[model samples]
Target: MNHAATTDMADAPVLDEDPFSDENIANPYPLFERMREMGPAVFVAPHGYYAVTRHAEAGIVASDHTRFTVEGGVGMSDIRKPGAWRTRSPISEIDPPEHTRVRAALQKILSPLVVKTWKDKFAQRAEEIAEQAVARGRIDGVADITEAFVLEVFPAVLGIDVPPERIKLTGELNFNQLGPNNERVARTLRRAAPIMDWYQQVLQRDHMRPGGFAEKIYEAEDAGDFDAGTAPLHVRSFFRAGVDTTIAGIGSTLKLLSEHPEQLALVKANPTLLKSAFEEALRMESPAQVMFRTTTGEVELGGVRLRADTKVGYHMGAANRDPRQWEDPDRYDVTRQTAGVHRAFGVGAHVCIGQMISRLEAESILGALIRRVQRIEPAGEARWRPVNTLRTLDVLPLTLVAG
Candidate 1:
């Protein structure tokens, strides 16, 4: 746990690449390779933070919270500092003891029984949507399938009732704010300005529908499971963390499946591989690409010495593709054992609390499709959405052939 410096700061390689630049954001694999090749950790001069690029080092930083803490916030900026745009999530931003309590309460609310019940509902909806998508033949996978399925079912389970347009706007705003304050962040904030009020109001306890999971969070808060007044923030955290990431993940799964028909065939031959398909997709293109942690003191990461209280960004997309970790990192092989190994959902304590929910949702939709469709082919180019820290599809044109 003690990461007291054993190496000189000069050993750390410094690079000037702008990680959030339009070109880099659009195609980061090249830069990711460069960063990983540089060393386990490299100082990204443009962003003014050290990046943990290699899979092993990223795991070390994530798991050993005593050395690299989340208290400074999970974004590029230290939330403890002045002029920070983000507020600390009562769940994600706190470290053990405090985080432990909140997470336990959340786990109780999202129990296995509750998740299984939701899975049944998700499966029914997925079948309905998959039937329609297969019938359509040609469709924008992002809009018609991924967004349609997740946006409908996820919020319904959360007990939220917000327009899809507003959810997308707010999601973009939240993810953008997690990165450096740039033009993209400014633009998204401006676009989301109109819905800001409603976004806040929707997470309030009164807005929660009866018998939904979100209502359970409020109930837990009332029972002293959480700090008073922390209920809304918990609701907000679930909404922010749950929606966009799942959409990105599911979209990536479909895109990968469509492009790699052979792999899709593997899943079709044995539908059990549906979960593996989603896991591999997430590994190839992680939804939450970069998450930041603060160095608690002078620490040595991948043999590089970092100064105390500095922000260290873990590029999940980069680490997930680290050749050191997997046999063929770039290739999307559905059979790869990537579920616990990949950095897609992260590692250690702060590993996404809702990962099971995401997997279940993905399994439902993908299982439904693989069962009904004979083949999935790319109809056109798959365009990447240029969110600062999120790697998601903007438009995926696909042609689905029925079984």
Candidate 2:
């Protein structure tokens, strides 16, 4: 390496912490605070990658594709390297102007009109489930509410059939694989092995429900909007990208509401605050904790010079809670206006296109439940499901006290 580059790398702060370790995964904010305190971007020695913890640096990395490209893949290990993830996401793993074309085509299929059509369906189902939960009085919010709702709705809209078990396994596997190839990845892969064929088959054209997005993708490809044989991958991307994260976000919102009755009251008193309640929950506990970007060349991030072609993780979970960007960052306040600012939905060209859909899903269910129940209270402790890149609740025990 050249002298200037070598000195820059050496000058960067090195943190010998594993963000993906079991303890950290369970409760990452503690380590995130330390990393954020260290610098804007800290070099993670064990993984040989830079960790972008602060809000500003994370935003820059997420938006500036020229400096930090997606061509090298948006995972910790470079997809260009041998033994890394073999397949790439047609939507998220490419850079413009090709990315622009792909995204436009996909957007055409999921136009606002098409998405708006799902609202009534989403609301109807959400109300039914919310009413059921209220009648029961106590529930596992994760299974009874969030998972139950998303697993049914998201796939129906995307035009795919997937068992909840496979969805969970694949969600775990995909997120874990995005980070270091640790035991978590291995365990999920093994459990998912039997369903691998089903997973692949479910996204095919024949499996698509008529008039759904998946079928529309195939039609778009036929009309020459996309390359032949790429439609299935798009459907796969849509399902994976849309489902679990929405479930996680909704699950977190419910758990948060149960924990803070006053916040629940805020939403219930002013139904207009319902949208912000979901946004605040996402800001407080982002679902997809981090996303990776590759350093296209020697770049200065948060004053730290990073090596070329290396993975840099932008921890949105950290950035969302970054004290510099937020007041009382640790507290859960439903009134917090964090939408569009929080890294939970990301930023720039690659910002989550499914964000509006996620928001709608969250609001539909949350609004229904909030209206139906007198109060949401903790029936038992909440549990987090650990995956390398995804932050989601596993179990949320709650009591829906009826008014």
Candidate 3:
């Protein structure tokens, strides 16, 4: 790797050319296209990091944690560094062997039997929310449906008493921390400033409701399922990963279905397709857009070589929509056999542990809505919230005529 050769790849097209730029964040697909066209691994000068764009390459990078460790921190900018707002999530911020132990403990706690028990609870809440929204004939899809379902169910499951109003502030801080310390990060940090100390209190065992997952984590810790003091961190990981992602995926689905009535009709006709519909939306507009790893040594992805100890950012949003991997990549179709094929939950050892919980939540709520609504009509424009690594809707108004 001579200076000239190093400079060539380093000078390649930046994937997120303007990370804090609203126009690019609002619609990142064009930039995604540019990165996919440039090379598998591109040196994004804007963020001063290399990003892996294609589907195969993204999967390879995500799975090869040995070559690409998570210990440097999973965000685009390392959170372990000074001035980072978030404390590291123990489950996601460590390499396997250690990660494997923590994850296995969580899996046992969040087992299928445990998740299955929540289905009835989610179903009841789904019916209540959907019926209320349908009665009104018009509703803000983001708040009325997506946020309503997640805010109700997710917190209850986690045992945390997080106020609904504080969610956006905390979420903004989390998403902004995933990228560079740009204006977005500064803005969100200020908003979340008042609650920073309280956020820590909420994650503690004393605040968790009895019989909730957070308490169960503490129980597990008592039983030696995990090391002492790691339980609260595990709970925080679930809270951070679970809530916003489900909201983003469901919100994106509603936004797309509103835009494409034909697609909406397809899901209405077959409620079972709700699963595939959500999966498709996740593939199309992933909630968490980018994830990163630190290279253990000089490694090769596609044909490009990365230096040891460097950060390798994997763009899941770009990978899922890669034309080479998906037919008519940009089109939103519920009929596509997207389940198990997409990397939205990640792949290999670090795949999302709470993925089943997310699917169950989506199926319960989206299924209830599909069954009750006759048609999903757009009432007004939908707007996306501009967070550095999350693609989510800020508002989605809709007219839901009852069946």
Return the candidate ranking by TM-score, descending: 1, 2, 3
Candidate 3 contains a number of clashing pairs equal to 1
lDDT of 1 by residue, 1-403 (tens): 3443454445578998798999999999999999999998888887788999899999988877888999999999999989878677999999997889889889999988889888779999999999899999999999988899999999999998988988888888888888999999999988888878888899998899998899999999889999999899999999999999999999999999998999999998888888899999999999999999999887887667887788899999999999999888999998898889999888988899999999998998888887988999999999999998898999999999988
Q: Is candidate 2 or candidate 3 better by TM-score?
A: 2
Candidate 2 deviant stretches above 4 angstroms:
1-10
Candidate 3 ranges with C-alpha deviation above 4 Å: 1-16, 80-84
lDDT of predicted model 3: 0.85
Question: What TM-score does candidate 1 reach?
Answer: 0.98
- On lDDT, the stronger of 1 and 2 is 1
Location of the lowest summed lDDT over 10 successive residues in candidate 3: 1-10
- For each candidate, the alpha-carbon lDDT, in order, equals 0.90, 0.88, 0.85
Q: List the candidate 1 regions with Cα displacement exceeding 4 Å.
A: 1-10
Cα-based RMSD of the predictions, in order?
1.3, 1.7, 2.5
Clashing pairs in 3: 14-44
